[model samples]
Target chain A: MTETSHAIRIEDRDDPRIAAYRDVRERDLIGRQGCFIAEGEVVLRVLLGGARFDLDSILIAANRLDGLQPLLASVPRHVPVYAAASPVMDAVVGFHIHRGILAVGRIGAPLMADDLLTSLPPRALVLALVGIANHDNMGGIFRNAAAFGVNAVFLDDTSCDPLYRKAVRVSVGGCLKIPFARIGSAEVLVDALAAHGVAAYALSPSGTTDLSDLVPAAQSALLLGAEGPGLPHEVLQRAHTVRISMADGFDSLNVATSSGIALHALRAKSFPLT
Target chain B: MTETSHAIRIEDRDDPRIAAYRDVRERDLIGRQGCFIAEGEVVLRVLLGGARFDLDSILIAANRLDGLQPLLASVPRHVPVYAAASPVMDAVVGFHIHRGILAVGRIGAPLMADDLLTSLPPRALVLALVGIANHDNMGGIFRNAAAFGVNAVFLDDTSCDPLYRKAVRVSVGGCLKIPFARIGSAEVLVDALAAHGVAAYALSPSGTTDLSDLVPAAQSALLLGAEGPGLPHEVLQRAHTVRISMADGFDSLNVATSSGIALHALRAKSFPLT
Candidate 1:
């Protein structure tokens, strides 16, 4: 745990000293495998505070190392810390850099849907996403889900990966904290939820049943669709279609925004004001 | 009233046949001057159905003209109709498109905050945005505002214009349906709301009061800031601070998503359940 084992300095972008940080954009397009990048001090601090993942390395511009010294000092002495000039760091990352601090961390192995469900308490809330490809929406949903006390999130096959850089960044690192599982399909999840006696609610603008009337159950799953096509007819049929009433003449709200509203409304009944 | 006065067909993208559809992205960035574009059939229909704005022209792909014949038949004979081949239309619009239709409408004169406030009914709900420059967020806020029965919206000096193409498109034409005004600053708007005897509620993650307590105000103005920086300290101090209670350890919701949840929570009190 000496200084030689903990810190490395690089002056060149292609120095192989920081191979983990190269081709970030291209890697992102292909789904960043093995590891995900956490940007900004706040997000990295959150990750460091949580036990969900192992940090691989820390990267900071040499000019900014003094500012992050206290944070670096707190990490395990064995963790590798790398510093580069600002321009070299930016060239390696393939984007104009602003946050100055970054962390490369190993993505933990995926969890099974059953494991996620079983880990929750009896009165648990979960999000079931369908066809939500937008990374921002996926991230926002996770952030909302965590804020509203949702026990876990289950992404249907069609949804985007929550660990994607943009999703993780947009989630403000909530993706790392929240327990999420990716299932093969909505049909399989619906059957599993039914077997577990969890009431499933499909969020639909055209739903006949008012969402407010449905009491929050001990275990409930909220299903959401993409912005445009909405939940497929079969998926809606499998769920108890519930609508958050809107003022007449307005179209449906954005899927992620609607998910936030729904989570807030549904979660309120279960979690009383503290 | 003749066919010649209404429908015009052009085979070339540069024929000057659809000047209204040219440089739409540039116009959006430059404040759109005197016009706004509504793309897709659904958005165009929403605009046509709403009484908030006047239509300047309608453009349909030549191959899809039959689909809109009924709508064309219903419109006033004075409005011009333009048709072009799908390729020509895409070239003119500077993007690949769908729904084979578009509409160009003159921008309505901006509404005055005082006028809109005076016209609002007792117990009216309104959204007051401060320093939210993201166009998509602006549009999403308007859509949420419209959906949750918010009577009007007031934008502070720092917000982007909601009429910009991306905003308008993201709003799904709700920007046209909702009444909105731009005020000079949050301070001025806070004072004005106080003068009108409306309760001003500033939404923040660190708010001292729960949002549920502020819903019963006879007239309320919900103040929101952009994501990250939140409401300016001065603005937060001037308005009653209210927070949407969240599960511990989670960060704040997305600004637009938070607005939706806040509006829905506040509006739920007045929702008529059958």
Candidate 2:
């Protein structure tokens, strides 16, 4: 780690400066002020890209310094890189973090819904998430959102924070690459998109139109919600309701799967599915 | 609760006959013999449908018996219905199962891939999984497979068991609805589909053809592998290589997302994308 000569060596679990990374599970319950944790090698690499969040600091197991040295080049010089042994890392985290990689990054001022919708290009496929609280579902939806070439993402205020540690990990850092904003409600987000000429296709088990029958516009957004209760009835009433055909009524697709399928359907159509 | 008068109360955790319900986390390691546990009320209802496997027994928190009574009517009279207090149930399962629902059932004889493939209808969409070891991916893939009207699922020998507790729960018992079988290798599964006049499309990040361009056949199969390694080269060579267009090279879709998107693409094409 010769290139990282300025790295700080964390010798004790009581280091007050590294407080943000302590007892993450407990800290997750209460807010992290304006800081969020990014874990594992992949997310750290994306964080080092410095595109989305500003890095506060990074901490990795001492043994990993050599392996990660190449990727650490882009990390800003002033941001402290804390290296600790596995024992200290485990002690501070309050669990055996097998990944042995962690980074603290500052969340920027929250993006507002209407301002974000107005800024997108005329040709865009947006993904609007509403009331999706499960971290895994949030991560999976964002992962698909990025992969399917979504121009931007809109999450309702009720949605789980995509920056939650597990969401970041599950998204494989894909969430970091995409621009996202949250609004007051699903209605506000959907209405804002409409004002910007983005057609909303709300997914539901009882949707009137099969996804295949729905034509994709130049600007379209697939509106999604949590698994069980699904999109709010009022929200579904406003947007064009669409559904993926299933084998039977025995089960419905997971919310993330709906995101992938619906986004693909919308994207493929705009590309002129021939 | 009145409808479930047949429920047997379990007060002790050490009863020898209830050994199968003991320490599920430990049992998952050594194997559950032929017995697999289905957790949560949704899965328990699916288990009681009596379509695939016979119900060995059901053990739910005693308080749940009343709530689950309507659904429990499907349980065969011959099968045992065991109800235990929350503490006793947690002690036996070695964890606090907040879902408070579990059912043990035999995993019948394994279905050979060749038999399952050859038995499918002429117009079929099959999902072939190769070297997918993650349980979440396994469950997610199965859940999507069911949603997209996949005719069957084929797992290569190296794939993780979809019946594992977490996978089963993650699948929302959709894995239970889907008829799946394992084969010796990806090569064998792809070749078997070929023999049945099914066109195989292997999904890879660096594939030759875009997914939208690949025409779906009367009988088609989408072959997928793990996220990082992806489909094997030999297997890719055997089938048509297709890739989903992504925003950039920084990230790829999760395998479950890949399955959902690919299956929808294939399914939508046959209905003739308008």
Candidate 3:
């Protein structure tokens, strides 16, 4: 088969051009400079479709190339697409490239929290997360945000990076599409949301208001925390506390599931799904 | 610290009493005769609270014994509690027993599908699952079912066993608390639900009615399928179809997240938070 115009075949695992794809598990993705790994075809497509992140190069198994032509055509020619046989691909990444597609993406300067808040339209739904350390939960939240039309997400410094590989895959590539920022602190986040006229609600089992009873404002933010050690008392006190009323003795819902339910309940009244 | 009456300290991994707790990962939990592994302190507490499943025995690390007194006291005197040093505990389970709590639970015969269905009160909500094979997803659905005050859960034989170890832990031990039955097939389950006058709603991306527009009857069932191959087309045809309206060009939400959202929506009109 004739290779696509953007294809660059690499026969050796030691090739210097493919350095970024090596020993991925050892790399500290959260603190790494500029580049992020987008695994699987769905996530790679999401990475390419958006303007916020740019393609650096892609390393894929030889057989996966033909099926991805339609998606690959959109990648600028300058963004090299490296094709390798399955064994070489596995050796480079230290694991089987089961999905047979991997991409090196260059992320631009993160959107500033204040700038992102100002950029929102008059009515917007924002998910403000505090201390959400689990990668899967982080990914699931981004997915829920995207599904229900949340304008953007603001993650506290304590939260894990959305671009982390597992989170990206678990989100089904949602982390690539949703707009997000690592804002400094939960206090600053709540204050900023209040200043922007967004009604911020902290979710907790002891929340004063029932989620069913509280009406959403024109602009709203749903505040969430990690599983066991929930939101700090100060953060909870800063925002209006709302609880997903449940059976009396059960622990609170998982953070991701809670977010989806809350987002669905508070979806814009005029959004028309109903 | 001195030991409690039920505590039996075991210094050797070869002890025959710890046989059920050994090399647990290698065992097939689904096809196993009558036993299920319940890990973590929370799940152990949940297991002890319920009467349907009886405790075979418990294995704990030496340090964890002091904190578990109240719960340990509740265990029947007939059931033995084995305390092992941390290393021996690790060797016995073939991994670090980090939470240091493991209980061998004996499941009674599965609740009959017709008996469970007929046992529901005048007004009830049920979550019926089809083809949910992932352990994490199975655990999650049980967690959500518990949170939203669902009366009972019915899983088709095609679904993974909810009592699998990972499912039990992921459910935060919800699998222990929630009354669940493994019924024969989607067809038989749907027919039984219809006979009981429960409105069964099969959830899918392509559906006739929006989830927001769904009106729950006196008794309701939300039918969910595995993520990629949603409910079998015939199953969707058999029950009224409903979808969570989402943004354009986006994939569907995670199966567990979808269940939480759909359950919350239907829960509002008919059920009250316990």
Number of the top-ranking candidate, with lDDT as the measure:
3
Q: Sort candidate 3 into its docking category.
A: medium
Per-residue CA lDDT of model 2 for B8-57, tens digit only, reads 88889997667889999999889898989889988887777754887788
**Residue B151 lDDT in candidate 1:** 85
Cα deviation of B128, candidate 2, in Å: 1.8
Please report, as a residue range, the 10-residue window in candidate 3 chain B with the lowest summed lDDT.
Answer: B24-33
Model 3 chain A: ten consecutive residues of lowest lDDT:
A265-274
- In model 2, the Cα lDDT at residue B85 comes to 89
TM-score, cand. 2 vs. native: 0.92
Could you give the DockQ of candidate 1? 0.60
Among these predictions, the greatest DockQ belongs to 3
Give one digit per residue, the lDDT tens place, for model 1 in B145-259: 7777678998889998888887888888778888899889878878888888888889998898887666457888889999889999988988889998898766778888988
Question: In candidate 3, how many clashes are counted?
Answer: 0
- Cα-based TM-score, every candidate: 0.92, 0.92, 0.96
lDDT of 1: 0.81
Off by over 4 Å in 1: A1-7, B1-7, B98-100, B271-274
Ranking under lDDT, best-scoring first?
3, 2, 1
How do all the candidates rank in terms of TM-score, highest first?
Answer: 3, 2, 1
